[model samples]
Target: MFLRRAVYYWQLIAALLLPLWLFVGWGIWGGGAWTFVGVVVAAPVLFIAILVVTLIIYGRSEVRAANAVSWLDVALLALWHLSIIGLGCFGATGSLFAMLTVVTGLAAFWGTLWQLVRGFTRRARQTLREFEQLAGQTPPRGHVSSPEQGDVYVVYESRDQRRA
Candidate 1:
């Protein structure tokens, strides 16, 4: 439980810090000068994707209520983040690993979105069921759903009175 909450928070901060790490890591151990060009493209996109995944997951009411990410979210995030870190290092071919990261990031997006849609649909179904139950309920012996059952008095005053 604590780990899930921590992961949720980390996902938020990762949006900024991970991309920065990619830039700094590459600058230090970059294969060549051309790597910076890739960083220029990948870093911003990575940043955006991180935020998007975080937001999509957070959009789930269950996550917000629990203040934690699901196991699936943690798994997808671990893959995506580790891949991003892999992108920073030059041990493997930069382009190859970068492509891997891109694919994983895309997967994360799709995964989070899928969960969001499913949660929303489930909640909507529950709400419709509740509405049906409510509609089936009969009112008590005396009920006043009509407005005329109650009387109201309006108090109107000139706006100029307050100005004085």
Candidate 2:
């Protein structure tokens, strides 16, 4: 279990770092610092953004408690895992590897956003329901009235009505 988490983050970090390394290595070979900054730094920054988004989603899931992970969260986690394989196999082709990384990262990004939106919307709805119920109470003004079956209801005009 612990190993899985380590591997997941390792893959994400590698996905970010490896592209930068390749770009910088190529730029050094070709004697162009501009390419190094434009390609190297940009690629990793984009990848790291994805990592941040995934962490946000995971953090929200943790906050929402057990079983709060939605299908989107699961899908993002799966994509994060798959990025390792994609990176390992296609790392030689920088463009293709970067594209794969971006695609997987986008999944993570949207997944987190979806989870957060869902969590907030759910909380808001719950609060609204509570407020509506409170507003609907008999004494809706200053104080809440406890439910008293006998005192709250009286048979005003029934054939079987009797004085208490």
Candidate 3:
């Protein structure tokens, strides 16, 4: 169960990181003119392709169960990808554009972080509530009760007999 929840969180993180990784890679290695041009052209197309594919997959009824893509995922993808493109465009100029790009990048980062934290908090609260419910239903150890008798009884039998 914990692993399943973690997978959902990972999906969100992956969406945020995809564009970030591309941006950072381009910044670090986009020295050649052709490389820069390739990235500038390819990135938006790639983003569009992925967006369409994800939407199509999520739209299908049969795929819905396996693909747990939410609107949050789509929003994160768009926000981060746009931020990356904006940063690439504005980062070269040491002016207001650069400042704006930095602000946008930081805002995207903070927004993603906030979403992750909120998700974790919600999941924790849900787990705690479930635990409380299960604990309430559980009877005390070595004790048994009969609905017909309307009485509580303690069993002094050995563990083996109790199992039987």
Question: Judged by lDDT against the true structure, how good is candidate 1?
Answer: 0.85
| Pairs with backbone N, CA or C atoms under 3 Å apart (clashes), candidate 2 | none
Candidates in order, TM-scores: namely 0.81, 0.53, 0.41
Which candidate number maximizes TM-score? 1
> What TM value does model 3 have?
0.41
lDDT of 2 at 133: 89
Q: What is the lDDT of residue 34 in candidate 3?
A: 65
The alpha-carbon lDDT assigned to residue 27 of candidate 2 equals 49
Q: Sort by TM-score, best first.
A: 1, 2, 3
lDDT of 3 by residue, 26-84 (tens): 67646567656755665565455444444443444423454444444445545544555
Which window of 10 residues has the lowest lDDT sum in candidate 3?
54-63
Best by lDDT: 1
Clashes in each model (backbone N, CA, C under 3 Å)?
Answer: 0, 0, 0
Query: Model 1: residues >4 Å from true position, as ranges?
Result: 139-164
Question: How much is 11 displaced in model 1, in angstroms?
Answer: 0.8
Q: In terms of lDDT, which candidate is stronger, 1 or 3? A: 1
- Answer with 1 or 2, whichever has the higher lDDT: 1
Residue pairs in collision within model 3: none
